[model samples]
Target: MLTMNDLKIDTVIVLDGEPFVVQTTQHVQMGRGGAILRTKLKNLISGNVLEKTFKSGDKIELAELSRTKANFLYKEGVNFHFMDNQSFEQFILSQDQIGEISNYVKDESDVEILNFKERPLAVNLPPKVDLKVTSAPPGVRGNTARGNVTKPAVLETGHTVQVPLFVEVGDLVRINTETGEYVERA
Candidate 1:
């Protein structure tokens, strides 16, 4: 059990039998009223945002969440398959559950699966991933009239990212998964 004081960003708590990740927290107190804690929570399973308020004496239940190392095998239709590193068991998760993280995932990559009560709920991707550039348009001469020149390059994973004009096909580039931006040539 957690009290209002325990509420903080990224803390997972249970409300109405659902697990929610705390996104933001604010504390407010009136002249003669008790302290109130307000929070913006994001549902781990449904990708929903909710605003909730709790009094000073309110108790919050911390969610029992776990992370397991997994190797991404492949994607079949809308399902993404993964093999648990420790248990050697395979599981599948739908595209809707993966959200934008799916764009950064590649076959045979390692990821962490977030589990609640032994059930997989979401995937945690590394902050950076290295991918090969499959296609990039030629950089035209004198294109630097706009200060810095950039071109869209298609990666092996089929994700497009803006890269410097110097980047070309067959180049391995590091990308920031959280921002979906090109980091540098690996």
Candidate 2:
């Protein structure tokens, strides 16, 4: 159990019989009225986002989310497989549950799986991942002065990300998993 005052960003809570994670929260106090907590929450299972306000001290249900480190194995049809590094147990998650992290994860990559009441809800990749560029066009000479120019490059994981024009095949690059953006050359 939790109260509106205890709401924190990224904290999972149960509302209306569904699990939601707080994306952002602000507690506001007015001189003429009572305090309220404004929150932006995302549905853990459906991936829907909603903004709602609650009176301060209002009771809320805390969701039981468990996170475990797992090593990604492979994909079978519509499900992705992962092995628990500690228990040697395996689990398969649906593509929708993986959300954005699916784009940055590669085979044998370490990931964090978020489970709600023992059911997998989401997958979290490392903050940054190093991957090799498997395909990209050559950059024209004298393009260095271009401002933040990028070219689409396919990674070893079969995911495509925009990399600097200077990037080429076989080059190793670091990518921000959360934003699915190129960070820098590895």
All models, RMSD in angstroms: 1.8, 2.7
Q: lDDT of all the models against the reference?
A: 0.92, 0.87
Clashing pairs in 1: none
- TM-scores, all models, native as reference: 0.89, 0.81
For 1-186, candidate 1 gives per-residue lDDT tens digits of 999998999899998898999999999996798999989999887878999999998989999999999999999998999999999899999887788889889999999999988989899998998999999999887898978699999998888999999999999999998899999999
Who wins the TM-score comparison? 1
Instruction: Give lDDT for model 1.
Output: 0.92
Tell how far residue 42 is off in model 2, in angstroms: 2.4
Model 1: per-residue Cα lDDT at residue 157: 80
| Regions of model 1 farther than 4 Å from truth | none
**lDDT of candidate 2 over 1-186, digit per residue (tens):** 788778899888999988998999988897998999999999888878999899966899999878989899998876899998889999888887786777778899888988888777888777899999999988876666766577899999889999988899999999998788999999
lDDT score of residue 119 within candidate 2: 74
- Summing lDDT over every window of 10 consecutive residues in candidate 2, give the lowest-scoring window: 140-149
